[model samples]
Target: MSTKQRIAIVTGANKGVGLAAVRQLALKYPTSPLNTGGSLLIYLAARSPERGEEAVQTLLDDAQLREAGVLVQQGGSVTVKFRELDIGSAESVAALGEFLKKEHESGVDVVINNAGIALKGFDSAIVRETIRTNYHGTLDVCTTLLPLLKPSPQSRLVNVASISGMLDAYSPAIQANFHAAVNKGSIPAVTALMEKFQHSVDADRVEEAGFVKRAYGVSKAGVIAFSKVLAEQQRQDGVVVNACCPGYVATSMTEHMDRPGAITPDEGARTLVMLALQDLDGKRGEFWREEKVVEW
Candidate 1:
């Protein structure tokens, strides 16, 4: 790889918003304000190898991508590769980290934690599974990849949070705990809160214990909180950490419901692409939606 080449990874990118973000990143990164005439390398990571490879082929065959000057061919300024990554699996996440470390000596420039699960029902098992994949799994990926992040203004870590994760959805006491955990800038503190939420769910006292009964909501809340704490911890390293709400998109996660106003996958991915490639003027930790920072 050229010294000027930039590398990025987008997890759970087989379809929907994740795939759209990968396409947009490849299209925009070359001419981005942060770019200075370098090749852009993006790893479209998905849990299924077959699906991941298919997504890469789809992008390569896209007429719009070709017309827009994004060439997946050899000697192109942009290259998209498929890497199997199951964020929910520690071994899978570790394998990706090791591959990057070995293949790209320059290190990784961007990481988008888009791999998450939202079950259909609410129960102790459902909540456990949701938190396991959304919160703990994401944290595992971050921890495993932290060493590979190149300390630069362009380096970014974007966590795919949701409006459902907004702190206002929780009770005041739960909100207070989140606030304190973020203030402490400690991963353990935030994790403890997530465990407490799970315990509440197990005991069938989520609302009474100051937490929302929605499993997805609580998991996303943990993601937002984790992003804040991570941002504070990585401030000195110049890695921008941010969480974003992609809006109500008509993706598989929400396909069961009829949302009239839900945006397209491309539209939902705009903010994510922006965060990955645009210069944020030194903004460190923030919750973003539609390219603007909003309260969580």
Candidate 2:
């Protein structure tokens, strides 16, 4: 590990936007603002080892990468490696932390929490699982790996949120609570609100409780809130934490929807790649889409 080498980890990168983000990172790393004349080591993480490795191989065999000598390490090249990680599993998250600790003593430069679930339904069980994976699981990964952040301007944490997660989707009271929780910079407070939403689902009173009936949307809202809280808390640490919506991309996650104007996975990954590797000029704790900060 060279002292100048920068390390990044992308979760749920086996396919879709996650994989596209990984690809863009590798292709852009050498010229990225954060590059410092050293290799950019990227960990493409997924729950399945076989799929993760396959993704790694795909990157290694990309014609563009090969033409640019990125795979051959001609200059400030990129290295894509496979790491099995299931963010929904605490044990798996912990194992990834341990591996990072051992492999990169210099600390991690970037973390993109893209692993999430969007089940089709409006029941308590569906709500619980959606929140558990999208919000809680993402939160767990952030907390577990926060200690390893490099603590520099180059350090970044990008949480893959959605426009559906915007606070305006909820009632005024519920939106106010989210704002209050984020202003307080309390992860627990935000988490409690998520729990309240879940309970409301069980009681068949989501709208009555001021929450929307969309579980995926509510969970993403929590992610946006948590991102703000984390950004406030990590201001001094110099880590740029922001949430982003990838738009309606044509991926496995959105195949069930009738998205006529859906963008390509590579196109949807542009903002994510920008946030991960571009110079944000000290931007932190905001929501972005199409490479611009937007209201969430």
Q: TM-scores across all candidates?
A: 0.97, 0.97
RMSD of each: 1.2, 1.3
Model 2: number of backbone collisions: 0
RMSD of candidate 2 to true structure, Å: 1.3
TM-score of 1: 0.97
lDDT of 1 by residue, 1-296 (tens): 68788899999899989999999998888689757888888999999989999999999988778887776583468889999999889999999999999999988899998989878989988888999999999999998887799998788899999999988877898899999989888778888988998998888888899988888988888899989988988888888899999999888988735667789989989999899889898887899999999987
Error of 2 at 5 (Å): 0.9
Model 2 spans with C-alpha error above 4 angstroms: 73-76, 256-258
Model 1 spans with C-alpha error above 4 angstroms: 256-258
Instruction: Give the count of colliding residue pairs in each prediction.
Output: 0, 0
**On a 0 to 1 TM-score scale, where does candidate 2 land against the true structure?**
0.97
Model 1 lowest lDDT segment of ten: 67-76
Q: Model 2: per-residue lDDT, tens digit, 60-81?
A: 7777777777654544367788
Question: Number of clashing pairs, model 1?
Answer: 0
